[model samples]
Target: MYQYSEFDRQFVRLRAEQFRDQLERWQAGQLSEEQFLPLRLQNGWYVQRYAPMLRIAVPYGEISSAQLRVLAHIAREYDHPDAALLAHAQATQDELQASQPGLTLAAPPLRYGYGHFTTRTNVQYNWIALTKAADVMDLLASVGMHGIQTSGNAIRNITCEALAGIAPDEIVDTRPFAEITRQWSTLHPEFAFLPRKFKIAFNGAAEDRAATGWYDVGLQARRNSAGEVGFTVKVGGGMGRTPIVGSVVREFLPAAELLNYLEAVVRVYNRYGRRDNKWKARIKILVKAEGQKYIDAVEAEYAAIVAQDGAPHTITAAELARVQAGFVVPALSPAGIPSEVSITAKPYQRWLKQNVRPHRLPGLSVVTLSFKRPGFAPGDADAATLDALAELADTFSAGEARLTHEQNLALPWVHASDLPALYEHAQALGLVQPNIGLLTDMIACPGGDFCSLANARAIPIAAALTEMYQDIDEVTDLGPIDLHISGCINSCGHHHSGHIGILGVDKDGKEWYQVTLGGADGSALSGPAMPGKVVGPSFSAAEVPDVVEAILDTYRAQRSSAAEHFIDTLRRVGHEPFKQAANGARHAATERRSHARQAEAATA
Candidate 1:
């Protein structure tokens, strides 16, 4: 919803030109890959597998319909026609060579992909694939968007809840603060190269949607006893190899000095954070090793520099004002929303019950489009689906959309009356799935697909489990199951917090998964739900769902009626029963395999 000024436009244009020149030189071989690596990365270009993938930054998941149209245009025109050749086609590479004459067109063989993420929607383009994603940046500069500071050891996309403006319990609007941090951190000279990547998130609501406790720095809006605006600061939290639920380093910080406090924190890390080991260099490690008391001491020491003995006056009020202006809330409709709608009729009831979040404004809601659907690869959508979403955003809502960190799209500030019509449109697009908070709605990493770090494919595993739970009644009865999958031990899919957690591991090229139980949301800080016994070494794809069903069945039998949740049941009965159930499933499968082998040997 924010418009760009002439300066903003010019800045993007200049950056685009810089990247275009760098790309040209690189293609000409004047700039070698070694020299061009940093340059290309700065421009959000990565030399992924078959082609060069360009990641376009969609800051904090907010984008206007106009900017999306720019993206569609880029995708259509620049992509190599031959690069995206469909699977199981008879056109061999030789045949294509014979037909096209003077072209070296590459085919991805069910492997080439153009996917998006919540953390800066980088428009990843395939290298040697017909499309030159730098072309997208050139066009993007004309509008307000650019692929700047998306990667590298820079301050990553400063995020807040997508429903920042609309969430009913918000103490104050957090979107503006997030936007301010983005502007401040964008290519800041002091922070261009840090000890590790920095992540910051904010939550203004009573219910923390930003995963506030999981960031390097988190801000929760609150007011003091005197009713003055302030924030509750949590620090040193991160997930990746070390999962730490951040502690209250500063306890409480006044809103007026929020930026100042943030500066102090960043300054501390940039100065003292470890740079020797890439894996152990995160600020979280620093926070963990040194203790919170040390961190607080450093913060206080640096915080005094704000407006004290002069530190450029520490981000002048005018600078913050300019950044805040960019995040101005839309003029919401004053007309009342229909609260008396019949919830018992049609699918609107399910949607209202699940997807809709209460807005600060009366009768309005922020609608989250859950990409975690039953039997689909988590966060995988084709070009047509992207265009469909863009079109849907245009027709319904305010032609504004937010990409969520949970790999979903959000159409915030939807008036209550238009819910049903919008629901119909989404259904036509196959976007009308009713498994938002259910077991089928899952979070999984892109394991063994694009990432070289993964041990197995979380996409297929997630899809298989969702397919297994096809019965709606059974799924409903399971009750608020949060199943998470991590490709490795790093916990990118947040397996630690899942009610039923699946961790994929490599047992000498054979795919094996670990299961964990009784994990729940730990924002106020939750406890670790240690893993149960290893589920499988010989588990087939088809049987994974059966294993999950057994776990659910175990929960149901032990639970007090249907009132208790899977987490609650697990908490009560402990992991021994679930472990036994999983072991039983594995044993049955192993017995079948042994019997088959014995029969073959006897016949011989």
Candidate 2:
């Protein structure tokens, strides 16, 4: 974890103070909502469906136990007591009249830790109040965390592969480079208000866990034949409205010049990216419109800058070393030779296979604790859960934890010998779900429940799916699957990249879902990279579960082998079978309704 210096601390303190003053003005009616929107957004505050939502940045998804404690505190204290009042205020008069006064808050108020994780590796508190927003920022600042640049049309959190330093096949430790970019981009005056929001991702491992190929600037660590480290820079890849994999702008860029090269790319986009239309504002749209001409322009810009004051844009070796020093690997000797461990139970075996992965160190392993469960929203962690997990990290692994882009938590360096004991502790805390890459291990955004922009409620769908597939035997037979859902085309849930993607859409004032099949993250194991294809017509939310089951059943029938993955099977035998199955399910549903209606008419 990176430690904050005195300067860093002072900067955060001052920024929080500035926001506090701004918030006071907004509350006092000195600043209109239109005027205050940008100011509040820059601090990661949003006026959501029923109340204000606050997004806190967890940079690169890394947090220490101390920081986790602060987050837990925020979850406990910042919840608005009048949250139900606000909800009722937004309801229709009839609905309000039908509701019981004390029914909503009958249970003890969930005081803290009511936040969910975002695909961007940030935490969002959905019920935060406007007046408490600055106070939340101050609490975050005290723990070396802040929400600055998280939501505005500025550089958002710079993310990397969660297994960056620990992956066995890692070519470089990417955290240092990610941190360097983080420091450089934070509060940079030049790119403060770009045409659209920008995202950057780094991948150091053989597998692209960071979804680098789908970001505005995707940097993959590479080494030349001579073994000198550099980057394979990909530009303009993004989803939402237009889904495109990035183009390789530069085949090889020396690591030392990464900052300068990126600045050149940013300059190109900032100078010419469309500001007239919000829909066409993202760099992906610009790249699509300009084609190879955009690449040529960026190259020419880089050349001109290098020919001019290149010294100003480039980072020095000393500066690089300072950032790298923060990512030191922990010292570890085995606790001792362990007694033989038994795994007689099927559930334990399944958990070990799914939740545990190899580490770079010989006797250590990385453990992913699934946050998805039957009753819980995917990626949600209450305050008590956070506190318990923090203590677990201190006791079992190091005092550090990593948040995955897939909406899970990783104790990245747990000793192999301590697995059994750790599993017990995790189980007690409702963190041991044994479904990491399985069907129930879903990824979803806070949809219509909290976000005003969402077309449908995503969390309920995820929870329903989890409940539907609670049978361990059924999921085991299904094998590894990634089912992602987004409330809308904004693609916050990364639905476009899932093996099975579900997107919520509004149709005649009703919530319907469109399904896309055969999509995947990164390059495929045997075939070309592809996005999920839209499978025929959109279906009602009520029909989604059955439709999903039908799709799975269709896959089971068409697959070459029991072990064949869903995406591979879908690719092998196109989408027609799945489409037929979905249509059949819809027809059967209609017939059932017709039969029931006929029986009622006969009795009458």
> lDDT winner among the candidates?
2
Give the alpha carbon lDDT tens digit for every residue of 1-604 in model 1: 5566787788889998898888788888899979988887776666543345566777667877677676656655553335344322224323422332111222223333334453333344342241365677778887688768766788877778777776666787777677767767888888898987788888887677677777889888887889876788888877765667776787677766776677788888888888899888888888888896657666675657654645442445687577678666666544333344455765667766777777676766677776765434666555556677777677665678888766777887677666776676677766656676678778787664444576655666777676667676677778778788877776767776677878777765555677777666443323332333343443443345567778888888899879777776777777888878877876676676678778989999
For model 2, name the residue pairs that clash.
Answer: 75-112, 75-113, 76-111, 76-112, 113-383
Query: Which whole-number lDDT from 0 to 100 does residue 330 have in model 2?
Result: 68
Q: Write the per-residue lDDT of candidate 2 for residues 1-604, one digit (tens) a residue.
A: 6677788889988999999999999899999999999998998888876778888888888988888888888888876547565546345323422332211111111222477888888988877778888888888888888889988889999999888889898999898899889888998898999999999999897667788888999998999999988999999988888888888899999998888888888989999999999989999998889999999998888887788865365767898789888888765435543434455676667789989999998988899999996667888888888898899778766788998988999998788878877787888888888888888888998877667898876765676678789997898899888899999998888888888899988887666789998777784342333478998788766567778999999989999999788888988898999999988876776676578778989999
TM-scores for every predicted model: 0.86, 0.94
Q: Show model 1 residue runs off by greater than 4 Å.
A: 74-114, 119-131, 307-325, 328-346, 523-543, 595-604
Task: Count backbone clashes in candidate 1.
Answer: 16
lDDT of 1 at 504: 73
